[model samples]
Target: MNICVFCSAADLDARYTTPAREFAELIGKGGHALVWGGSDTGLMKVMADGVETAGGRLVGVSVDFLAHKVRPGVDDMVITKDLAERKAELLARADAIVVMVGGTGTLDEATEILELKKHGLHTKPVVLLNTAGFYDGLKEQFQRMEDEGFLPLPLTELVFFAEDGAGALAYLEEQAGIQG
Candidate 1:
């Protein structure tokens, strides 16, 4: 199954990034083909590159705005128009969503995917790659949605957490039930 990995392009900064390489390698080794927004550097590229090196297929959905900005030597690229178009294209192609810790764009995209799940536009499972407790606040906000009577109990099951790459890949297999 195609797994959509949403992460920031800003993670190239050492101060802002975490050891998500473990996650990348785990997913790659698990044989889950990657479907992600195209960015040659940063955490996104880190994951894709690791996957490709590990003999995994990493499919990049490149938007017009980010195409020129993409890192050189990406294995596969499909260019689109803009951010919204890019996300749409990615979603169209993915069967699941794995959200890694990231900045505002990542958060916005995660929320948008959640919204799609809420509306039943897609029933694709979503997981959070929670490195070093980065997503505590966001999880709290999801809890608030339940407290405010907007969200439901099953949603807690919808977005599971994996502390590292291994856990993320394992949970992906558990959630998607696709070994290959």
Candidate 2:
């Protein structure tokens, strides 16, 4: 599968990096490809490196402005004109989506994808890897949305909340009809 992962590009503590690396390793060792923002720093770099080292392919979708930060020697790279196009390209290339702990940029990507899925624009499985309980609040918010009827579909159908990398991948694999 071409798993698109949206994550921070900023340097972070080991709590975040460890699980991200572990998830990336799972992507690679499973003979899957990584579709991501294509930054060569921080958590993004950690994921890309882990995936590449574990024998997975890297497919980076980088915007023109941040092209300088794109990783070197990825299996494939595409420079989009802007963020909108970049997200579209990433989604187009991915069979599944994983949203890791991140800031506004990552959150933007995650919500947009979920919104698209909610509208039936796509049916690809989405997983929010809530590493270190970073997304506990967001998970609650989603539940509230479901409870309040703000979301047409159940929150569970819209996205899966995973406490760790293994659960995230396992869910994605099962959704893809790949036995763990």
Candidate 3:
């Protein structure tokens, strides 16, 4: 199954070190591939670089606005005029969503996947590699969704939690069946 590896563009932040490389290596060695925003730098690029080194298949999707800013040299470029188009393409091709710790950009990527699942546009499993509870606030929001009855308990199970890259890809393969 195709995996959309989502994360922040924060190259300067010290936090990008762990999740970036870990997620990339996970996707690469897990016998799966990567579909993510293309950038040559930052967490986004870090993951992509690992994917490349591991020789996994890669498909990078980025909006034109971000095209110049994206991680460079993506194997397959899925460029769009805007974010909406980029996201639509990503959703169309992805079978799973792996969210690494990121900033607002990463948050939006994960939330969009959640929304897609909510509306039944897709049922892809979304794995959030928390990496030191960076997503604690987002987890609370998901809880709020359950509390308000917007999401049922079992349905809430669609979102998987992991603390490191190894755990993330293992759960992804087990739950998503992405050996190919």
Candidate 4:
């Protein structure tokens, strides 16, 4: 599976990086490919490195402005004109999506992916890796939305909330019908 992971490009504490690395390693060791924002620094770097070291393929979708930061010698790299195009490319390349600890950029990516899925634009499974309880609030908000009838589909069908990397990958694997 080509798993697209949306995560921070900023340097993060070990609390966050540890799980991200573990998840990346799982993606790699499972013989899957990583489809992600191509940045060779910080958390993105951590994930790319772990996956690569574990023998997974790296497929990078980078914005033209950040092209310089794209990891060198990835299995595949595509430079888009802007963030929207980048997101589209990332989705187009992936069989599944994972949202890890990140800032607004990551949040934006996650929501947009969810929105697209809600509209039936795509049916790929999405997992929000809720490491360190980072996404507890968002999950609560989503629950409220479901309760209020703001969401057409059940909250569970929209996205899976996972507290650890293992759970996230397992869910994705099962959803994609890949025997792990």
Query: How many pairs of residues collide in each model?
Result: 2, 0, 5, 0
C-alpha lDDT values of all predictions: 0.78, 0.96, 0.76, 0.95
Write candidate 3's Cα lDDT for 60-149 as tens digits: 888887778766565688789988788889888888888887777777877888877777778777888888788777788777877788
Query: For model 1, how does the per-residue alpha-carbon lDDT over 23-80 read when each residue is reduced to its tens digit?
Result: 6666677776888887877888787777777767788898886778665665567899
- Each prediction's RMSD over C-alphas, in Å, is 2.1, 0.5, 2.2, 0.6
| Residue-level lDDT tens digits of model 4 in 41-123 | 99999999999999999999999999999999999999999999999999999999999999999999999999999999999
Backbone clashes counted, model 3: 5
Clashing residue pairs in candidate 2 are none
Q: What TM-score, over all chains together, does every model reach?
A: 0.89, 0.99, 0.88, 0.99
lDDT of 3 at 94: 84
Clashing pairs in 4: none
For 85-116, candidate 2 gives per-residue lDDT tens digits of: 99999999999999999999999999999999
Query: Which runs in model 3 stand beyond 4 Å of their true positions?
Result: 12-15, 152-155, 178-180
Model 3 quality (TM-score): 0.88
- Candidate ordering by lDDT (highest first): 2, 4, 1, 3
Candidate 2 regions off by >4 Å?
none
lDDT of 4 at 31: 94
